[model samples]
Target: MLGIKNWINLNSSSVFFKGTRIATDAYGKDLLVSLYRKYINGYPKFFKMDPLSRLGFVACELLFNSEKVETLQTDNLNEDSCLILFNKSASLANDKIYNETIDNENYFPSPSVFVYTLPNIVTGEIAIKNKIYGETSFYVIDELDATTIFNVVSSSMSDTNNNRCICGWLECSNEDNFNAILLMIDKTSDTLFNIENLRNILNYK
Candidate 1:
C-alpha cells in the first residue's frame, strides 16, 4: 500500500512520498514522463510542460494519490481552494531554453516553449488538473522560508472564500535539478503542514 506523508519530494530521478523512496528512474525526465504516462495518460499537453511544471505536476500526483484515506482534494468534490506555489529559480531553466531558440542564428521561437516562460504556469496546470477554482498565486523568493509560507497560508485561510490551499515549493534550475514539496491544508486541519513537521515525516534521503 502507498504510504501517507505530509510532503512529496522529486529530486533528480527519485520520487519520495512522505520521505519514503518508492520510485526511481535513470534520469529526472524519464521519471516525470513515466509518472505522467502511468497515472495521467491521455494528457498529451504534458509533453509541452517545462521542467518546473513537470516537477510540480508529478509531485502533486504522488501527494494527491498516495494515501487511501481521503484528506484535502477536489474534482468530484468540486472544492474551492487556492494553489500557492513558491520557488527561487522561477522559470530560468526553461527561459534559458527559450533564449536559445531566439538566438540570432537559431531564431526558432516555439509557442509551446514561449508559454512555459511564465513561472505561474505550473500553478495553472495543477489547478486545471485538480479542479481548483480559487486564487492561484506563485511567488518567487530568494529561498524557501517556512515563516513566509506559513504567513501566506494563514492569510489565505483567513479568507472565508478560500478555506483550503495546496501550497508548497517547486524549484527546477535545470532538467536534472528539481524539487517539489506540496501540502494539502485546510482551515480546520488536524496535521499542521509546516516545513519542519513535513521534514520530520519525510523519509527521503
Candidate 2:
C-alpha cells in the first residue's frame, strides 16, 4: 500500500498538518512569509521566487522537516524520489502579470515576470531545494481530479521504483484564491493512500 507519512494543506484560511491546524494568526501571503521566516530564514533565493514557487517551496519545507519522515538523509541523497504536482491554473496568474508588463500602452516586457510563466517551474523550485534527481513533472487539469492524480503518481512511482514521492495538488489562481495539498508518500502497508483520501484532503478547509 502507498501510505502517507506526512501531509500538509494550506489555503486562504489556514494551514493544517496531520489533521491538526498549525498555530498561526497570519493568513494568505503573510502566512507563507511567516513560515519562511520561522523555519527558512537562510534561503535568500526564496524571496525571489514567483508566487506559485514560493507557495510550493514553503509547503515542502513544512512537510519534509516534520518528524513523521525518518529517511531524510536518504530522501535527499537517493535518486528514486519523484515529485508530481497537479494544478488547476497553469501559471495563468503569472502570465497575466507578465502580460501587464507588455501591454499595448506599456510595451515593456519584464524578464523577471516572464521566467515564471511555466507551471513546471514550481516543481523545479521544489526539486532544486531538495536535490531530487528523479522525475519531476507538473500537470494542469481542469480541477483536482483525484483519479487522474492517483493514476499518474502510482505509475510514476512504479516506473521509478521510488520508495518515497511528493505528490499533491497545488494551485494559485490569483491572490484571492490559492490552495496547496502537499503529502509525503511511501510504499508501506500502514496508512491508506487512496482516491477518497485524496479528495478529502483536496477539499479540506
Candidate 3:
C-alpha cells in the first residue's frame, strides 16, 4: 500500500509539517516569501514565480530538503516519482492578473504573467527545481474530495514506472489567501494511503 512518508502544509498564516506548527505570521507579510527567505536562501527565480508556483515550490522544497527525503534520492534521480496535484481555483488568481494586463490599453500583456496562467505551471516549477523528469499532472476539482484524489493517484501509480508520488492540493485565491498540502507517498511505510488518512492530514490544523 502507498504510504505518506512526509508532508508539509502552508496556509496564509502558518506553516506546518507532520501536524506540528513550524512558523506563524502575525504581521500579515507574504508567508511564502518569508519562508523562502528564512528557510530557503537560494533560488533567485523564486521571486519571479506567481503565487501558486511560489506556494508549491516552497512546499516541495520544505519536503524534499529534509534528511528523510535525501535518503530516498537515487543519485540525484527522481524519475520514478510522479506529481499529482489538485486544486479548486486552478490558477484563477493569476488569470485575473493576466487578464488585467490585456484588458487595458495602458499596460501590455506580460509574458511572465502569461506563462503562469496554467495551473500545471506549479507542478512544472516543482519538477524543474527537483530535476524530476517524471509524470506530472494537475486536476481542477469543484471542491476538495479525498476519494477523487486517491483514485487519481492510484490510477497513475498503476503504471509500473511510477514508484512514488508527490500528491496534494494547492490553492491560491489571493495574495494572502493561499494553502498547500504536499505529501510524499510510497509503499515503504506502515501508514496506509486511504481517504481517511488523506482527509485527516489535510484537515490537521
Candidate 4:
C-alpha cells in the first residue's frame, strides 16, 4: 500500500502541510515570493521561472524538506521513482505571455518565455532540482480527477523497482490564480492508496 509521507497545498491565500496551515496571506499579494523568502532562504533561479514553475518548486521544496518525513536522499533516489502531475490549464498562463512577444516587433520572441510554454517544464524543473532521473509525466484534464491520478500512482507503485511517487494537481489560470496540492507517496506506509482518501486529503484545506 502507498501512503502520503508528506504533502503541501498552496493557493493564492494560504499554504498548508499535512492539514495544518503553515502560513496565511490575507491579501494574497506576492504570497509565493513571501513564502519563498521566509522558508526557502534563497534560490535566485526562482525569480526567472514562470508562475507554474515557481508554484511547483516552492510546494515540492516544502514537502521534501518537512521534518515529518525522512529527508530525501535525492542523490540516491531510484531512477524509477516517478512524478505524475495533472493540471487543468496546462501552460496557457505562460503561453499567452509568450504569444504576445511573437507579434510585437519591438519585443523579440524570448527563448526564456518560449521554454515555459509547456506544462511539463514544471515537472522537469522539479526533477532537475532534486536530481530525480526518473520517469515524469504531465497530463491536462478537464477537471481534477482523483480516480485517474490514483490509477496512475497505483500503476507506478506496482513496479517492484519503483518506490516513491509525487503526484498532484497544479493549476495556474490565465488570471494568475494558483492552486497546487502535491503529495509524496511511498510503499513504506500502511495507508491505503485510493480515490476517496486522496480526495479527502486534498480537500482537507
What tens digits encode model 2's per-residue C-alpha lDDT throughout 110-201? 77779999999988888887778877889988988889998888877777457678899989987546898988888874668888877787
lDDT for every model? Answer: 0.74, 0.82, 0.84, 0.81
What is the TM-score of each predicted model, taking all chains together? Answer: 0.85, 0.92, 0.94, 0.91
Off by over 4 Å in 4: 26-29, 68-71, 104-107
For model 1, residues 13-85, the per-residue Cα lDDT tens digits are 6777655687555577787888887766877777878899888888777777775325345354435567788
Clashes of each: 2, 0, 0, 0
C-alpha RMSD (angstroms) for model 4: 2.0
Worst 10 residues of 1 by lDDT: 68-77
Residue 55 accuracy (lDDT) in model 3: 87
lDDT tens digits, residues 101-153, model 3?
Answer: 88656679889999999999989998887778889999999998888998999
Q: Residue 177 lDDT in model 2? A: 68
User: Could you tell me how far off, in angstroms, the CA of residue 63 lies in candidate 1 after the best superposition?
Assistant: 1.6
For model 4, what is the error of residue 36's alpha carbon versus the real structure, in angstroms, after optimal superposition? 0.8
Ranking by TM-score: 3, 2, 4, 1
TM-score of 3: 0.94
* Alpha-carbon shift of residue 39 in model 3 (angstroms): 1.2
Rate residue 197 of model 2 by lDDT: 79
True lDDT of residue 94, candidate 1: 96
Full-model lDDT, candidate 4: 0.81
